[model samples]
Target: MDFNFIGTIWSLLPPVVAIALALKTKEVYSSLFIGIVLGAILFCLSMGTGFDGFLSHLLNDTVGEGDDAKSYGLIHCLSDPWNVGILVFLVVLGSIVSLMNKAGGSAAFGRWAAKHIKSKIGAQVATIILGILIFIDDYFNCLTVGSVMRPITVRYGVTKEKLAYLIDSTAAPVCIISPISSWAAAVSGFVSGGENGLALFCQAIPFNFYAFFTIIFMLMIVVTGFDFKAMSKYDERLKEWYERNGWQLDEVSDTKLQIVEHGVGAKADSKKPKETKGAVADLVVPIIMLIVFCMTGMVYSGGYFDATSANYHDFVDSFAASNASVGLVIGSLTALILTIMMFVVKKTLKFDDAMSCLIKGFEAMVPAVLILTLAWTLKSMTDSLGAAEYVSGVVASSAAGLQMLLPAIVFIVAACLAFATGTSWGTFGILIPICIAVFPVAAPLRIISISACMAGAVCGDHISPISDTTIMASAGAECKHVHHVSSQLPYALTVAGVSFLTFVVAGLTQGMGLMASAAISWISGIILLIVALTILKRIKCKKE
Candidate 1:
């Protein structure tokens, strides 16, 4: 409850060390190892431990158990329910993705998509839409959408760099807006006890300036077919590759191509591309089932249909009250089972291949699994140090006219924290408690402040180079991570600037009116479109 300055400062040491190591080594795994070790060292020092005791304690805490040898600080932080859920979700999702990949589902979808999409811009738009649709999990959004979209985008001359931007933009941005998403579940769990969590989320949506505008910005780029200076640099490289290789470079590499071709050959060898019976059904049926089961599960978990079918809103209300994760787990399991059945019935996959596909799907998730584990560890360490609470206290105490600028300050704080943590959900988790507790003292301003925090978290996560969504975006596009970071930064910054301005004006005018704020956002979106177009024309001129 109270600030522990020394404890907080010491707590920050691990993440700082981790970042420094990452930069120095340019190896993500090594950097995470350094971070974990640094965190353990600090924990040991704080708890008065010898090196051996420290090692024992660290191992115990890392693997989710703690004994008398370990400090309570280490145990409680590591065993947080949210943390446990996140870790499980990451591992399971990874397994599912590996399965999808192994079944040739992803490649089949990609090849089919590529043959139809003719232009670079169209492919980018398709990628964006797919990103939006896969809102259940950001990790899923990134890998599946990216893997499926990558081949198509490549065939149409869209730079991998641009594809990364689109994928990253859509992942967290869309998830934060949807109330049923895993991201929302995490955020709501933090802020849901007394307050109307759903309403709070809906209120935040209008002012979620970064997410609102990022979508607009992406659409602008797609519609105007414009590339910024940084993006243009990457696009030029792609064009050069195409000119020399005669679009051969546009095709998938021989290894991936071979996999797809072999799968095709097994089905039918050059004799008329017979629409694999229920190929569309193979894809569509399972997805529809996923949605239906997920919704039904949510209703059951939330207690939405409790022996009465009076009205639709009440039914929805019942669903909201149910346990969401139960629904998610059930839905995901059903989808997985149905997918296997579809493969068998359609002859789309053999029993051995299907089993192999599942293994491969889990295998592909290894990197994600590792990254998630490290990320959670880092988050636990930070929480144990009490960094977020300390900062929240400082802001609550020091700021002037706190009521008036509460929203803007929340936004700024959330953004800064998210940037530091490279996680929007973590940022939201850290700030929501503080916002809920502090904002009520200011009455109406509480709404604005809470909204600001949500918006800020989204903005920060959108741009953070270390963010999982950002990494996924790059992976999805097959672009260098740095390239995605560099190309996307300017656009993200531009939106942030405008969002800040809008928040300031809204605060000053006491205009937290949703329609007005939305109108301003729309106008701002249009201006961004014009600017993107102008920039694209300039790039064209330079090329000519």
Candidate 2:
């Protein structure tokens, strides 16, 4: 596809406006809304619309396009199935999230977790594990994990900024690595159609530098208790709030150790905390059901089961026929309804309180929903304008000896595109086919290249402020979006840099032992950690 400079420029304007507004205003929803409106305006201008026509086009694009050329100016771009699907998923997910919160499931989980998990690092670790556990869907994983883990982390003086970073890092990074995750499904589908898809995926795992390293980096941060410069600012702010308000940390501390040691005083209540029977069961069973149903759905959709002497295709045809979204929607709704019933039946919450919880959950998700809409709108605008394709084409064309540095090139290109689009899946979709077509014969290089694409996509998606994961992370931490972005950038870049270097070495060596490469990556990470720790110590010393 040929590039349209004007279209590209116009398409790029939205994110630029978002970034500018975000930086200047630090109001995430406002920034995203402005970006969406700006994109609509640019779309109108591109179509040569007048002010009235532009307004009409904006409505048409947001709603649906009609057959009229004037209507075409407004709605043609967003009429695509993918765009519509994205919008539906975002809104529905928002509703689901709200329901989960409203049912007191999230609060119950948080309160329950806080009782068991002690120490700041443990809370962060729990957040990461929860993020990893909810791997079936990144959107679900990011928001659900963040919502459940935030209050516990906040109680321990674990800054929301840090919590957001942990949530963001684990969400996409863990999803890409898990075979059954939405991210893996998308990439696997792409590779399956290509030569030796399974082999390519396996080989790519070793070179998924970003995902591997980011996870390690998160763990290191958790273990070492080192805060980045921006994160220190958050820490200071949190401390100031505590000091000025004369908030007694001991009074609010809810950890099991604290409660066991201090008894009633630990809970900020003199009365014994009421234990609802099956409180844990209420949380655990629904999650288990969601997983079982989703896996069964995937298997059914993929046609993996056939008791009769059915052919493989027949099995796949029957089992794998349903959309994944249907499974998620059904699973989330079932879980939410069941949780509500469980709470009500046990008298853990009255019906009215249960309803109130659901409303609060939905309200908590308002920011995420708005940001998601704008992000999707930005994505639609870019895709329609061919911004990603144009940029990919430019990178593919301009790079010298792409065959030699295919892995590195893939990493850079995928990272840039994913960052631009705020979607790893979209980046994978765009780049995987191109990689497969270009590197048809070189199996090792193909694996490496595709892996690089996945890694880069995850890396960029994890770090990009406009990414749904990033937004959800901020919401999870209850931190400012810019604060999360600023605090997390240094850590993300640290991993990105190390991953890039590892990719270079891996590409040059052409599939050197995975252990050796992992060791090298680990050694580099240790060095980064030591340096970070040293710097943090110096800062601490200076502060004291």
Candidate 3:
């Protein structure tokens, strides 16, 4: 009965099935569940086990006491400390957002922004600036930027899909490039072979084409008002829907927008935001406090406060050692408590109303939480099926013979694996070690290849429907998850194509050393992006 399918071509079936079904049906929850089930079934077949084995793989009680005896099931995924921490952070963050909305902090900020930012472009620029500034963590960036900028973007007729796209593009791209961010930590921790992981990560930053180019492309689209066909079609539909309803484009409120975003439901009505005494500080202060507390929590988690710890008192080292999930949970909870206290003390919200946000916040995030749980379970299923091992083995086997074209190859492979797995750090773990093993520690090509791994992982994570960051972006914008994925695909793919070409140039020119290869690669990337954008603009013009 043994199928011998684990770590083979068949290992990819579950994710491929899930992704295809989700994209086709536009039903994320069911699609992910089916994938998880398929993975468990496959595992059972491979191991020559029966229904009992399938059930164990599906939702087991086995404790992962050691690496050899590790269990990957829906229950185990949910029970993992890191997973629990993330879920806790999401609930706290959702509550904080609810409290802000009920206290009128969001409304106040929107009104304030309305006077200062008079155009759609201005609003988008502000959003980009805010996103760039919050580079400590992508999850925090996604939710915080969406909560703060949603009102202004809505006022300016920014479609919820577009808002989600903006939130998503900025979240991981900015995080991947920031030295003090969680992504840097993840990448640094993945390196081996007698090299300084952090130092190598810093070296790889310049060659992370997708991260930089995605930012560049976002700015271009924002500045030029150019939209690809998919996004443009959505824009037209939004305009027509607004016009049919006899609402002025600029006057559309966030509440009515939500109705258009996800159908007419009582959920939209109940979540209709109310403005308290309009004070910008009501929004600004809470956000500032969140950032401060979160940063402090990250450092503390890294043992910055412990005298006996190696990372003690060193900001960068502490950040590199920080546990993002734990830090985010701690920071978000403290911020939530303070925000509720501030609102109640100021009479902006009654204590009872403030307490009510607990349920409201959890309610708001239920959809995201459900999607995330399913996604996590699906990932667990893939793990049980040896998806990572399969991908790593493939990369390791093929990499030695593909030196000059290796960076581009790595980028594409990493992108595909990450896209299927819906986890960038997992992709990093699989590809980075292979890259390290293929080239000498100080080889310039090694650095470029490593950068490609980081870039491709972020790129795939950026566009993947099941990625938590993507889900967070959808939640943050309060957009339909499917809509966000569809609208952002063309845009993300455009950048990915350009990034792929840039990695090719880097690989071809590695003989010139890191600086020369990087310079050539960046210059070529910019030219290619400009050419691509120009072509897209012309197509838009012709369509118009």
Candidate 4:
């Protein structure tokens, strides 16, 4: 149904009410659902329909209607190739993680890390490196890194809040920078016209200040052991309450902590983690194989080796046309099989145990998957209300002759939309097109403006409680959801502040072309992060 509402701003209501309710209630699912309901209501009202019409539309979106029903509503969203692929990918990856944990790979890895790491800084740094290494997808990165590193970090007295932040900081940030990733596929699909989506995305990387600087800022925060406000309380409280007292985390948090600390799941021997038999290879091999297989899967789906395709000889050309969702599922499924066999053959875990992990894995991912689906549905609702078109119109209208200011403006627009909607891809679908339309495809400003859209979306996702990445990060770290969001906001905003200035610099220097502007803006952003962190550290010292 037509939901334009005669050009009114009511299209913005769903996300606005949802974000407000989420923050105020420290809840995500209900808030998002409520927002979805509100948007459906708005859509109905705009069409001059009533509750019955709303139910009919909801049914059409969620379930099947007659042949008159379009194939692109809420229900159809679940069947969308991209959406289904991601869901299956999450399930498979979760199962692989579960299998590893059940077979003592994770516990064994933690024991090994504790011996070699020897310090808190080393533990945190190891987590960062591992997080960066898992640049396949943000969902995979968050869960795998969190589960593998949680035990090790806990040993070093690193707070769950801090670990959650680290997992989150690395997830969307690292994935966005990776050329072969699910995120790359999503970003690639958003841009229209010349240079191809992947090429444009690659060109825009240098201008993506928020992402690269988040990594930098995250490193500095960990290396310096900086803590402030709620983070400080949680860090010190946990350090004193659990680590200092030698109390189990069971005394500190909820059941999820039990799962993370004890490695819960059938055949997961929580009995003696110290005696958990495994080598560093048990941990390293599966991860490496997963990466390799996933990459292979991606390239394969892109038809890299398909001789029939004209671009078969060129890997980059193939990958630019790849389907991220398909490749991830294929790779993760392959990795899961190989990992299970390795565990069973080694007697690290039984075949039966591996079989049980399948269910456990799916169970673990249920929360992330459910949240993602709801987020998607909410996006659907807003989309039905024409939010993207409205926002795009506003941006295009205001963007004339303001080339230098456009990047920052796009950044703000993208950030607000992502924050309220809690979905980066949704923001991308809205803003990237507007950016390309406003600045000619050949203009340096086009690349900068597009990068701002991406960077802003990531920034918003980093902090928003309702963002799937944020929720997954919390699940991975076993931190309370709201705790993760609230604790990470200050840190995210700090990097975002510096990123805004860097975008301004980039926009100003666009005439110098990609490499020059990228270098200048990136270096400036790093300096800004260092200076900002230094000042904050000094202020903390003075307060102490």
Candidate 5:
């Protein structure tokens, strides 16, 4: 028999095993590798191949010498041009960050912020605002916001867990809703069948309940001083430690510095100079230049600057066709070169000192790079096993009988898929096409359902322990990965629950005009979220 697990229930095992083991063991690398091996084994069994087949599926790529030829596995993922570009961008960005720190730009900014930002609330709010302002890409937002706000937040006694949550809450949520972002470009690329993808994405933004509500929920958390029990425990521990040590609120002690610098890839004690002639401009100029060059690179890659290319178009159109990986690599490399020159020229760092940051930066990003590589490989495993096919088939089968409840159902399915695979872009690639296939172009429910897909994907990505964004946020804030995941879950779920209900309302009211339906559902979502938070706060108060 020609055996295969393609589009079957068994295809889900690899990612399921990966997610389950990661959550239980709290060890990502081995868990992901194990899942990859299992998936390869499954593929071998399905193909009726022997040990060689397993080896090929695990570490090698196939070029189709026969009918059974396929392309997947870890080696293939590492060799992929897109993945390499992302890796390059990460390394370059890491070098830039290290240079900034070595030149004392970060410390200067920290001192500047501490002097001006008076309260804990102000620091937290500033973090959120900065996160929101960097809406071009989530990866960029996570690292930038973390580096910029970490010192200020620490100075105010905000827990690392809390800072990670703030960075994460704004990252994907903001990008998913912003029309000028890399996320919009990704989403637009999926709109097939002669549809205007960018326009559709804009129309759907108003209905992205999860993304919008998450931002609101974060602000509410900051304003109301509300913390979920998991997060509160972290807060309480920090408070007790401070009390025990008699540490002043504003003091940046060596002990605290060690805590902030721990496990996030950098050794703060060795690399940073005691004194340097660095100012806020050293930090601010590079970041601003990075943004400018990155945006230009994205548009250029999309052919906006290439009049001879067939894809040549205006800024938005070009960006829609742009390659994020390529653009980021190009932009970050340019920014790194410029930043090095700036630091060296200003005498903040010697040429040799600036050059040394490249190594330090690479070292700092090793943890993130390893996690990302494994995550990508794990995703490759699921691809080999046909997990996306299985999920899509299931969704297609279930769509026939449930019209009004469809949006909510889609949201749940998308969330589960993203949570399992730990890839929001992959989730979008899977579900958004299915959504377009299920509903007519003119159908009111089409927009709502598409919005649900995006919301659900972001929701899952936000909470998934293995998600790259989650990993980046932890790395950015210098928090333990497990601590960030465990602390952020309750808050993400709270918003997710409200989002699900909102999707239900949106699905039911699809007969109404788009504006009316969005307004009604949005208002209902706000009320429900506020009520849920109030009740939860009371419960927390009672527990205290």
Candidate 6:
């Protein structure tokens, strides 16, 4: 836990090990635990002791002692309020989704959307729009978008890998650019003093090339119906599977069956109730409630309701100060209760059936929740290793002569750190403070540089197989985790390449006005992305 003396190259070993193993072995849990153990060993070695000291660090520090001590490991991480809240929300949302599936809400919406969306393009485009609207949090966006759209997409013959990519692309990228987002809250918290953090964040949105260009790239792919690199091969395989196995969803499921409603001509049993009340409005109303309640909860948590609090009218300030984990839990719980009542009152589900959904939903989310818990604990280990301090020291020491290229350099380093650690929040926490310190308070380049940090963090997390958002995206899409990662890598990298170049342009144009510079850089980046993707499309065409 005491990281002062151990902030060395050894500090980065855990995440590096975890990432490398995930790549080589295609497993996440054991790799993460190994990294945690390695970090604990590093803690011991830094104490200038042997195996006995290593055991103590692993047992007492990583796993924790009795109760009173300020422990800094897995036990401490799980007990933390933020982690607990998000875990609870995941379970609750899972139950709600299960209920929707059971009540025939999902199937009914699928039937409804089937009438309107006639092509693959419509399916993909609609998924993107839905992803953009759910801008509160990436986890919610990933799962909800996947669950709600999965039926429609399958109906239209969209591949699970492609669906996963769409879900992943929209979740983080949309949140990074949206002002009223948890990503915004995390970014603004990095800025010190009485600075209008939200204002600066909004200003940087235009310069967030990775986030914006990822969206552009995604839309172009969906519109054009193209795939290249590893994605191309996977896309072909999926087509073959659909052709050979028919339109059943089982080929994509990993042992566990997807939750589907009781229906169809020959498949429907006489005992099943009619799905009269479960219309598209059933899905629409609950999602609307969740979004509204989430916003209300966030503001309330930020003391917007406190008459004594100054800046209560300033919604941006309240949003910047709100506790996202607590707010999301509150919002999700309210939405769940409302949804249950609505279902029961409409006679879509009996009280006993709705109650059973609680357990079913928890079962569905166990994998995601387990992975998130591990990811959070992994973050705790990285913090205990002082990954932030080490990154900060390096950035501070190197800032003097590289002013023009510093933003690009910071972007790359942040990307690598996030890719290794699989966490954008942790990466931004480590890098954003360093950017703020290196440049003047009011400097346009300072804001540009910070934006680069966030954009790059999102970009890396987008590609990382171990990233929690990526994991959730895979789960939501009901795709193989490895398949999702492989298919999404090329798309993420293409955007990241354009984003890095944009940072270079932004750095060069720092003397220019912020808005003008952002405009120029964004235009250039979008052009580059389109060009690069077109080339890939051409290659795929030639191969075909």
Give per-residue CA lDDT, model 3, range 1-544, as digits (tens).
3487788888889989998999899999899999989998888888888898889889973534677687788888889999999999999988988888787788778877888988889988999899999998888999999999987887777877888999998999999988888888788778766666778888989999999999999999999999877787777776776677777866667677556545422244757654457478878888898899998888888888898855575778778778888888889889989988888788888999989999999999999999999998899888878888988888787887888889999999999988999999999998998888888876888899999999999999998999999999999988889989988999999999999999989999999998999999999999999999999888778877
Evaluation by lDDT, superior candidate among 5 and 6: 5
Model 4: CA > 4 A from native: 1-7, 62-74, 243-274, 310-313, 512-516, 542-544
Give the TM-score of each candidate.
Answer: 0.81, 0.81, 0.95, 0.90, 0.95, 0.91
Of the two candidates 5 and 6, the one with more favorable TM-score, higher being better, is 5
lDDT of 4 by residue, 186-285 (tens): 8887876655788888888878889989888888888888976868888667645555444564233222234435532313333532455667777778
CA error at residue 163 for candidate 2, angstroms:
1.2
Q: Which lDDT tens digits does candidate 6 get at residues 304-407?
A: 78767674645767788888888898899999999999999989889999999999999988877777767666666766677767876887788888898888
Q: Write model 2 residue lDDT over 414-487, tens digit each, in one string.
A: 88777777888788878888877776555556666778899989878877778877887787666778878878
Give residue 365's lDDT in candidate 6 (0 to 100). Answer: 87
Q: What ranking of all candidate models by lDDT puts the best one first?
A: 5, 3, 4, 6, 2, 1
Point out the worst 10-residue segment of candidate 1 by lDDT.
259-268
Candidates 1 and 5 compared: the better one by lDDT is 5
Lowest summed lDDT across 10 adjacent residues in model 3 is found at 259-268
Instruction: In model 4, state the lDDT of residue 210.
Output: 90
- The ten-residue window of minimal lDDT in model 2 covers 256-265
For candidate 1, the lDDT comes to 0.65
Candidate no. 4 TM-score: 0.90
Error of 4 at 404 (Å): 1.8
